[model samples]
Target: MAPRANPTLRQRRLGAELRRMREQVGFGGSELGRLVGMSPAQVTQMEAGKIGISVERLRTIAATCMCVNEPLVAALSDIITEREKPGWWEEYRGTLSEDFVDVAEFEGQARRLTTYSMAFIPGLLQTGSYSSAVFAQTFPPLPRHEIDLRTAFRMQRQRVVRSGTTPYAAFIHEAALRMQFSGPTVLAEQLGALIEDSEQSSVSIRVVPFDVSAMPSSSGTFTYAEGPIPELDAAQVDTSLGCRIFDAPAHVARFRSLLARFESRALSEEESRDFIGSVMKEMESKRA
Candidate 1:
């Protein structure tokens, strides 16, 4: 088969796992190639995500490498089986950055989601007008069409939270509550929407008040997506360039710990709802 010119995040992840397994067993590329009836170059290409691996081949590789993690192997097999399926984000593939599409893929496949935001409401919880307003503030001033496209993409991504099946937990800082992205009116509407969403049994919204004596030095926003198996979990963080996804065990663990810290410092769900109501009232009072 011809090598893939560009592989998606999931494809890359499968390749990484295969490479990790081989390394753990102390088998060099040429050595594994001989055992698997492939050339060393073929093994390298598969491990680099440039070439695909069949489920049978994957099983053979796992057996050769002495991997005993049945659950992880099954999860990897599922990924391979779903390789031909296209997600909703495919509609915007050429129009938007691949990173944007990857983020949507990550969120859509997750069993549960946890997010922490310090300066803005989590994208999944943002309302239409609020999201448009946030996009309008892009550093280089995006074209009107580009802004609209981004807003539409973001609104579409909220479906996972709206499905009412996937458990979602968001910890947003008090500072974000007062940012007034578009204005007090839009911010008020956004906060009101948050309260309504929090009413869902599967949704949890917690506010981290400014009064908290200590906050982590890392100010960036991040999301943790729980996979079927702990080893397959992924964490995503936004940077100036774009979203970065981390699936390595160590990175995922650190993100999990960071989210725990955020949760610990945030208000309870009920208290958060009351706090948000008060903020909405403050916004309304300002309008008066």
Candidate 2:
């Protein structure tokens, strides 16, 4: 098959795992290509996610590399088989940046989701109006139509959280609850939605209050998606330039540790609901 102009994060992850397996077995690209009946260039392209690999070829490579991890092999096979499947996020491919679609895809495939937001609410739990207000603050002010498009897309992505199949835990700092990016009315409504979501059996919300003696230092907001296996886990951080996805073992490990710290300092789910309720009441009073 011809090379892909742009490969999704899933594809890249599959490629990385393949490369890791090859390196673990001490096989060079040319050596693995010879064993797998492909040229070194073909192996390189596949490893770079510029080209697709058939499940047959993937299994052959696994066998040749002496990889005994059946679960990892099976997970990789699943990703390859689903490579052609079009997700709901595809509709916004041209209208929105690829990062947006990638994030949605990541969330959809994740077995579990966890996020830490120091300044703003996690996107999965944000209401439409709150999302619009957040998007409006973009440096180069977005056109009204574009802002609306993004807000709509965000609302659609919330379906994963609402599905209640995959477990989701959100650790939000106290500062976010008090930030009035939009008017009090919108914030109040958003807080109300958050409390309602917290009631879901699969949803967990925790708050990190300012009274905590020490805060966990983080570069910025990040969402961590737990894959079918630890090797496939991914962490996504939004930046001024764009969304940055980290799947390297070290990076994912660091993010996991950061989330642990957030949990340690955060209020329990029950306390968080009460805290959010208090904040919502405050917003209601301000609106009055």
Candidate 3:
């Protein structure tokens, strides 16, 4: 079979799991290949996510490696199926960065999402004008066309919340709520949209007020996407160069903890709405 030049994160994840199992059993590529009836190069290719593996072969490898985790094996099977499916993000491939499409892939399959933003509302929760305004402020100002493309891409991400199936929990700060991305009118509309979305049974919006006595020193934005299984979860964080995604157990766990800390510092659901309401009123009063 031909090798894949660019494999999705899910495909890579499946290979990673198999590689981990092989390592646990103290088997090298040559040995594993011999046992699995494939060439050593084939094993290497599969491990590197350049080649696909069927569920039956995957199960055989798991058994040979003494991996008894039924749930993990089941999850691997699911990944095999998801790897073949095309996603909506494909339409915007060249229009956006590869990382952007990857982010959509994660969000599309996430069973639950937890995000923490200190300076801006997350893309998934942002309204059209708010997103366009945020893009406009980017340094080395983007071309008008790029700004429109980014805005549209961001708006597409809102389907996660609009679907009303995946549970979404966002922890935003007071500063973000006050930041007039597109002046008072647009900011007010953005915050109002947030308030309305918060009413969804599956969506939760929490605010971390500036007056809080003690809070974590860390200031960054991250999204933790939980898959059907815990081991498949991933975390995406913004970086100077671009967005970075982490699925390794250690990285994912740290992000999960970081988000939890942010959540703890945020106001309760009911209180968060009241806080947002006050901010909305403040904005309106300023306009008067």
- Please estimate how well model 2 matches the true structure, expressed as its whole-model Cα lDDT: 0.91
**Candidate 1 regions off by >4 Å?**
none
Q: Model 3 residue 103 lDDT?
A: 88
The true-versus-predicted C-alpha distance at residue 245 of model 2, in Å, is: 1.1
Query: Which residue runs does candidate 3 get wrong by more than 4 Å?
Result: 82-85, 217-219
Per-residue lDDT of candidate 2, residues 1-288 (tens digit): 789888877788888999999999999999999999999999998998889988899999999999999999999999888746688998888779999999898898899999888788899999999999999998889999999999999999999999998899999888999888889999999999999999999999999888987776776689999999898899999888888889888999999999888878789999999999999999999999
Candidate 3, 93-211: lDDT as tens digits:
77788888888988887899988888898889999999999999999999999999989998888898888989999999898899997788888888899999899999999999999
What's the residue-level lDDT of 215 in candidate 1? 78
- Colliding residue pairs in candidate 1: none
lDDT of each: 0.91, 0.91, 0.87
Residue by residue across 89-155, what tens digits does model 1's lDDT show? Answer: 9788888999999999899889999999888999999999999999999899999999899999999
